[model samples]
Target: MGASFCSPVDERCTCSLQSTIHAFRFPLWAVKVSDFLEMLGPPRPHHRLQEEGLLHEWFPGMFVIFTSHQWLSSTHPDPQGQQMEVLQKALRGMIDGSLQVHEDLVARSDRMNLSNTIRQHIAEGFLFFDWFAIPQITVRKDGVNEESVKSAAALAVQSIPAYVELSNVFIALVPELTHKDSSALVNYASWLSRGWCRAELWCRLLSNKIDTTVIVIHSPTQAEFMFPLDWQHNSIVNGNFTVESDRAIVVQLGETAVESKIQHLQVHGPLRDCRFYCALRPKLLCQERADRTLQKFLEDFRFGSLEQAVKDTSGMNAVMCAILSGDTGMLRLLAESRADVSRPMHGLNDLGYYDTQTPLMAATKSHQDPAVLTTLVELRADPNGRASNTKLSSLYMCRSAGHVRALLEQRAELEHAALHGAAALAGPDTLRELLSRQCDPNHILAGRQERFGPLHAVALFSLSNRHAVEAAKLLLEHRADVNSRSSPSDEFLWECRKARMRVVVLGFANCNMMTRLRASMSGISPLGYAALVGHGQLTQLFLDYGADPTPNDRGDTPEDLARRNHHYHLIPMLATFAT
Candidate 1:
């Protein structure tokens, strides 16, 4: 079969070149919403504003709405004209109490009601729109006001975070429009990926508001209130378009917001939103999202129900939450309340989602505090619990040698597959600890088939990880078998032989010979894999440690494989020992 092609709509592989190129065109100046409502004549054209570099100031408590679109080039009545009608209706609903503001954000008591705050601002109807308000300079000209305009625009872009913070309400206007490629212009997935849209989104989320809700307008008639935490499932923040200073601002904003203990419980009934929020944004800037603050704070508080305590959007119960946040006290409370010790949390965040874990599994992976781990083990949580997707146990996710020892104290499985995962992910110290514990250094993942050993795992790890050499050195020092072969099953050999026969019958003998021969080979040693992937250092390391350069079941030596794969530099080194 032919290889499958990636479609433009495939989010994982394809990004819009048009959207990426135009992300820098942020509106520098905007007119007040009230000004737009009171305009008597056709307002001065964009050309005039571009020439003058003049703009009106936005007041505190003003409503700000951003649209992910360029100015209309057509003379026809624009579809965005309908957005004004929708905003007006929403405003009316907020004022009359017909529509509910975020239930969690609205005060339960008489003091500091967010609903009232929203109503007061809706009454003013003052808004900040980029196109109607911000001066748009299409091009630069030789004049005094030209530099002034550029400077003003620069300042406005720089102050976007502050602008979003000051605005009482934020709206994302994404109406469906036809693209030149026959695709919809205002898709939530597409709009969310744009650098400028993400910048606006982060500005609002990281703003000082304790309970921020973004209004997303999908069409002229429909709109929805989106939880800011929902966007954390992906990279919703723009890393580019803005400068390093701006990126730093976003990081600080996330840190500060996380510290406030995200108020998601008030917005959504169950702690699911909060659970999802915490899971997605834990402990890294660009690599992950943020830290765990909200879950840690709940230790001092009481929940109304077990459902509230148990229901996590990402499948984490209060027990797992406590363990993940390193809150020993919270863990004790949940355990005492008869919370299921073996409950699996399916993390929805970008980091830990694939590896759904039991409370024990979460603690084991975090390698945070031994007290937290000891408490879970005392509570009878399973140390050998596996994630639903990855099928990896707690012992496989140990962060360091100390963590491995701690899990070992709790009686974690010390088998070959488990050791393989540990060697692949952990540093040299962790590997040494496992080896010292009498865990076989040359152990293979499978029994009869002999899938892979420590050196093979080390070879794969070296491709991406910086400490591959050190890890290899550690395994070598532990006397891991350098030339241990990973044997394939008889079933695989039969399938390969059959496929090779078919290829030869079809008159493509040479084309499929090498591929089928490699496939038919019963086993490959550490040096074989090293030569296959073209890691010269790792191959040399194996050779220095006395690896066998002998051929496998298919009569192909390490040198022959490297030469076949066009690794000319490795041929000389392999030739040093190859007969």
Candidate 2:
């Protein structure tokens, strides 16, 4: 029989046929929070949980928490029960209002919080952990009833997305842990790279749930709402899998999720969101680009006419659509019809392209062709324009040497901030172009309170860039200081306090206290920034270059920052290089 299909808008629809089979063959099992707390000693298997009468059938409004994580071993997900301990402490903290779910450092503006209502629900919730929910028959040596056991295991695996959709909260239990067999550091980064984890993430984010926020638990005391850009950058098609054969199946699942999300939004009446999803559908699916005619484009984007498209200045306006679609001719046509080439973006923050960013900035960040940048400039888009929210020039968003050249040719000002931005966001080619223009690698902004150099910028902002190491190396080769410290002005601290007070006044949780405290403090060296983010390769590179591990103004050394952030894997390395 062909694969069973279901409407994405259906609240009770299962996306896959295997998940439907799973309903009868292997039901989704969960454990109550109170009962889970009572389980003593090592982590138990599904059979033991069922035997102990701890497993319960998940039902509507049961407040199920679906956990996504990386396996620590081939046979066991948590060989040492370390992850379980962290989860237990975190849950207890949530129930008692001790553990505050903070926003990620980069997502302070999102104002994410775990409300008391949700906390109450979590206090009376059930957990769907794969180890405790799925049959662990594959690890058994005996082959008795092996086919039935294998079938059950496969069905459970396929039903994971359905379970995720049924849950109220999604938690990524990514506390820094060591892999048993490979001795690899299994943490947030490693978990993000796993194929199965990405599938679970897509399932939840693309689900029809009203609140699809993912809580990433880094340590017992530290948890944050995930930055949307993380999932957007790490597509399931690019995720690593233990078995290569699983790639095809998982990729298919991802396509279904994406399609379902787009269809649901299209039918649902948030026209702006529908347009955003439709425009990004190709990129999300990893499909080859197929150029569309202007007629087809307007129809697909739900525009009544070309005039309607041109007059709009929303997030996915005519100019933005043309830029994303890679149609330079359409961009020119829109400009000719009085479309504001310099209009700031709005209502697209969920996709990581923030508000107040110009079309030039979006094009630069999206790494569009150099020709696209040239076309925008030729159409009178300001090359030196800065985002109103961030005060960052379009030059700061350049991804490649060509982008820099395109902006520079239009007289985009090359200053210290440009070098800092290039080191953090761009590749080696872009950094090389900026340095060749004699941009100082260690030039601290004289007036700004956040006077950070190029090296410091790389450490703080280059988390997702694969070219971060090479970009940093380029700066170091240009004589950037390995131990240059940040000098936050007193005004910076005052402003931070004001911002915190504003958050309090607005009745939002102060989820950025840690980040604010770090920012207000002065004399944080480049090494400290790297260690704060647990960038192993960059930290080692700084150590190899003789970076001093001396404590900063707050008396927190690089090792202290690493340990505080639960980067235990970096402890030995930092200790060996400690001054």
Candidate 3:
């Protein structure tokens, strides 16, 4: 296949652990992967990374990355009182039993009692592997300190044979995973093919970066997603992750090297012709394509395309690498084999597809997957296929989603895709499945970039608010119009302030890492976008939820928009919630 693909896209071939006692056998050397996943910070009052607004998620581009500095932390060579007397003599060799239960105990207790304070001081801390919930199917029920899961299971039995040689090169290149969450999809390649949980409870959950995210079985047609591949599989619309091209990988059990793991493997299909695919990269053309072999190149094109009129200038053209990997089955096998399916194959230094599309508008990208937009509308592909939001099409992105009405009820015509909004971007099931097919959850979008209106489309937004308050209580039980029939009125927080600074600098933006509440800018509400952005306790949990101190005809109020935006670090908690 492309000359039997032999590694070497070189970030120094990913390995490093001069003293690997067990941080997952310390590898995947240059470690910096975050096309959005930076939440691991709270172990015991360790806050200062600019106090981490921290509510994060989305890694649907399923990943694997490795690197470790190991952690003897009290400054080594018997320093903090001889490393607390060698962790109190390894907790008397774990209370006189002699510690074994290996399989990479967080890479096998990197040289004992995992830095013991008699098992990290137990008020309810210790057990590991809790990155975004779903591994052996739910841990952290609070119970793992067997001397910190044994020193990361002797560094995960030397990092599970380097992820079984990188899941044998992504299970011989994406054959479509094989079938339904294939055992929670590779469960980190079945936690290193059934050796499961060692490196002492995977370093007591990656040394307290105790994060979350796992989709499984990453390659034979891609799926290995550690965290955030965009979730909400059934209710409240959007970010579905379309499984079933046999199985699509979600791989990442432990680690060894190759830049600590992640080789670009998403591959969706249908919702009018979904896209994504860049499997096995490293051809190196270099003009300043940012290079470490190009980081997340728009999630695997990494940094090499700001000009694609439908890529594949040379090799590996699985439907032009699946429309440069927006990949809805190689973009419907290259638009059912025609392949130009509206040609905007690359151009995203910051959005520029500029053209028409039919492959279900190239898989509906401000984030997609309701069974790959219902298999690109049963392969006819075009549930109102037009682009740049002329009025509204992708059925307002399947009306805030119920699995895109469980796949547009299996073959299109779910009343203009449930009344259009995927472009202005909002879906609690594509707008309550377009007001349950009557099409008027206050139906706005007269022309271009239409962001919000029904008194800012109701909610109890993301970080788990329960599906935009259950699709705004089913569009206020179908009466719809929360306001804005063409507002001279405009005061529901100014429409939440014109979408609230992209939701206070991209907040509820996750998938697979699973977060959903999104829409904003009417003002003074989401407690003035969390006190205009200081988040004082998520602006006191959005003023317990009433959120309206007044001053609209534009005089400015959530404490004068937090003192005219200086946010003097959240103006003494927005002047104690404006008295």
Candidate 4:
């Protein structure tokens, strides 16, 4: 593919011999701003400017950089002056081998192995930022004007995916920012809310590769890394500013992700049912999988065996489809062919996906009949496989469907994740079974706290009165710690604050009228969160169990949180246990 200044978008510009695009050469060892901007040969070297289509194939070592609009300082001579300063500092640190820009916090908890990939990219790679790489006529020295480069710039926008695909890592330079508009833009939420930003994110996540890395730079020292699954829940739902065109692009992106592994659609959250809509979209768009049909699926799919098929293809198998769709005749036919019942699936059913899970996990998520689970268990299918990716178990997935009993009977491991998940999601009977099986009601697990007991888990998920009352009663009966020194969920509370900011930005007549907000919800207890969320009965229960109503690490009492959130009714009850 010879470099052709092909004008797919403009008529004025031709592949004129005189026209040349510029790409800065920055060695990973020592990055000097001056050296990076020096004029190269007349024609652009090995690197393809964003104007050239399918650049990722040519420049597979480039970095797909992401940042907030705040980085574009309007007051600076160059809008990207601040961003360039930060990048220069980062490059210098990398050269000195002194700075390890921390990967996103969520990546640390994921199984994607993203941290290592980012480390490699930072140690040796190139940059593909549009601001510097794509020549702006106004900034160019060759007497080029905006009109002269209009077609190329337009083509550059169309080549974003190629740029992203070729890149080694997606670096999001997100600082804690407060923009003037705040309309779909505030801090990390700001980058997440933008349509183009999401398109870039999707390009990386829904790519043809596995274990992709996304680096988040909160500050020069506080850079974090994350994987696609870590951000799927928020990314799928937080599109308040997305237009119809963006939605169409998102649907195409999602289809590509799903085609890689159908279970990719299982990730969802509590925002506007967008996850469901996004998943169902490919079907309406008539998007077909790569293999086209079931027979072709089996013929072309590569894996070790039936078990590996479930693991690799994520239950996109014809036999699994039959089992999931309740086609008993088809299932029987497959069974007659010596189908393995112990095969674990990594796919999505109606409810969710269970990564590294057995057929029992599938039956559990799909809410299949008790008979289905029984057949698998009787066939010696292991119920020991946990849903590692989801951080929840097949047993936990079965909670809302009341299938916990069957799993308990089959002896699923009553581990910390299982117990904690049950604490948040299961009923009294499920909790009783778990406790009877030697699952500790006071088991310490990572959540809001580094190691919170089951009671703390219950406090966060107690939205319904029946769930709150019965589950709390069961835990307390089993000697649950009401005054457990659990750390409050600053992460969740911060997200709440971001949601509030979005409300203020889009709701208020003038966003500037809103006062500056604080970001420290650091030390809330079970009682404090309960009070803040306005759960009066749960507060009384905590008080009954002798939970101290004194001030927490942040010096705010349950009474204070209750008053702040306007749950005045809980104040009298909480005041009874006064500090």
Lowest-sum lDDT 10-residue window in model 2:
1-10
How much does each candidate deviate from the true structure in C-alpha RMSD?
17.7, 5.7, 21.1, 15.3
lDDT of 4 by residue, 1-579 (tens): 000111123211111111111121221111223343332422232223424422232332233333323323322222324444545555554444433443223222211122333434444445555553443444444555667566555555555655555554466665432333322223344566555666567666554333234665533333344423233433432444435556665555545544533334333222212233333333323433121233433333333444444433334453455444433443444455666665656434212344456666666544455555655665566666554444455665555334666666788755655666666655676677677767777776653333467776676545422366678878888888777755435465555366346535653211111111111134556787677545656677888887887565556677876665445557788877664
- Measured with C-alpha atoms, the lDDT of residue 327 in candidate 3 is 41
Q: How do these models rank on lDDT, best leading?
A: 2, 1, 4, 3
lDDT of each: 0.53, 0.76, 0.31, 0.48
**Cα miss at 390, model 1 (Å)?**
7.6
Prediction 1 global C-alpha lDDT: 0.53
Q: Which regions of candidate 1 are displaced past 4 Å? A: 1-282, 285-306, 311-314, 345-357, 386-392, 413-417, 447-450, 490-521, 559-571, 575-579
TM-score of 4: 0.46
Q: lDDT at 513 for candidate 3?
A: 10
Report the C-alpha lDDT of model 2 over 1-579, residue by residue, as the tens digit: 000111124322221222211123358899998887776655788877887889999765566888898888888888778888888988887777767776666644424456666677788889999988988886533554878777888898888978887777789998766789998867777788888899999888887654567888876666777777678767899999999999999998888888887778878747776776676677677777676787988988888999999887667887888787666888888889898999888877766688888889888776677888999999999998888876788887887889988888887787767877778767789889888888888988554567778898888754555667788888888899998888776667565556545545642223343543353346788889888776777888898888998776666788987876666767998998654
The Cα error of candidate 1 at residue 308, in Å, is: 2.2
Candidate with the larger TM-score of 1 and 4: 1
Tens-digit lDDT track of model 1 for 75-189: 3113335435444554555555543332111011111112444455455544555544443354334453876766756655555655555554566654433343333333343
TM-score of each: 0.50, 0.87, 0.26, 0.46
- Give the residue spans of candidate 2 off by over 4 A: 1-25, 38-42, 140-144, 426-433, 436-438, 445-448, 462-474, 496-520, 575-579
Off by over 4 Å in 3: 1-321, 324-333, 336-392, 395-547, 550-579
RMSD from true fold, candidate 1: 17.7
